[model samples]
Target: MNEYFIDTNIFMYAAGKPHEFKEPCVSLLSRIQSGELKAAIDTEVFLEILYRYHHINLPDKGADLAWSMMDLGLNVLPVTKKDIEISLYFYQQYQDRGVLPRDIIHAATMVQNGLETIVSVDKHFDIIEEVKRIAPSDLI
Candidate 1:
């Protein structure tokens, strides 16, 4: 079984307003909850969710969402200083590839945790040669 890194956007799309990606992302999450898909997420994912929701005056909802994700039973990896350092290295190399800084950090977390695949809707992951990005639709 291939282990994938669960990107923050998966949770966002699943929880946010309805969009083209909502159903597929919700399905992807269901698979993870059912243990049909093996995945993990780093601490940074929680931070993003918390920050995004808090900015919209939903801090409690953000905390609840974080707790919900934690209850999914998937492995939660840490984002160490070393991961940030590695992200910097990736930034220098992929800066011209249109990769976002947050993505670089995600990639670094994946690398540090021995993961190579990510479940996300972000097309930017396609530019990171070190990691593979799988769309939620494709999985469901």
Candidate 2:
């Protein structure tokens, strides 16, 4: 119950410049940094960080951030073939209600990993009954 599946937005918001969410996100990250909080992220989140940095024309920064995620000592879950198979089911169920394919994958990973809670700002995750979405602010 104390562990959480960290979402891409938490990293993105914490890395980007000032924003409404930056403070809470950073605070949550700090907790993670100190080993006071437990967290994990799927490999897709690693690639998404790379893609986002590439999309922003900051490939170097992206690489650094991706590496830093590994350095954070958080559990970086691999996306196994079985996880993708699970995603197919969640996608079919939640796609029409605003859940994206990547999120479905995240949800599937949660199910496979026995993680019932996620730390994220995405409201769409609320539609998935297998996991609960906790905002970074809420946890801090």
Every candidate's lDDT: 0.92, 0.91
- lDDT digits (tens) for residues 11-114 of candidate 2: 98988899999999999988998898999999999889999899989999999888878767688899999999999999998889989999999999999999
Off by over 4 Å in 1: none
Candidate 2 C-alpha error for residue 108, in Å = 0.3
What TM-score quantifies how close candidate 2 is to the native fold? 0.96
Where is model 2 more than 4 Å wrong at Cα?
none
lDDT of 1 by residue, 10-107 (tens): 99899889999999989998999999999999988999999999999999989988999987778999899999999999999999989988889999
User: What is residue 54's positional error in candidate 1, in angstroms?
Assistant: 0.9
For model 2, give the 10-residue run with minimal summed lDDT.
64-73
Point to the candidate with the largest TM-score: 2
Backbone steric clashes in candidate 1, count: 0
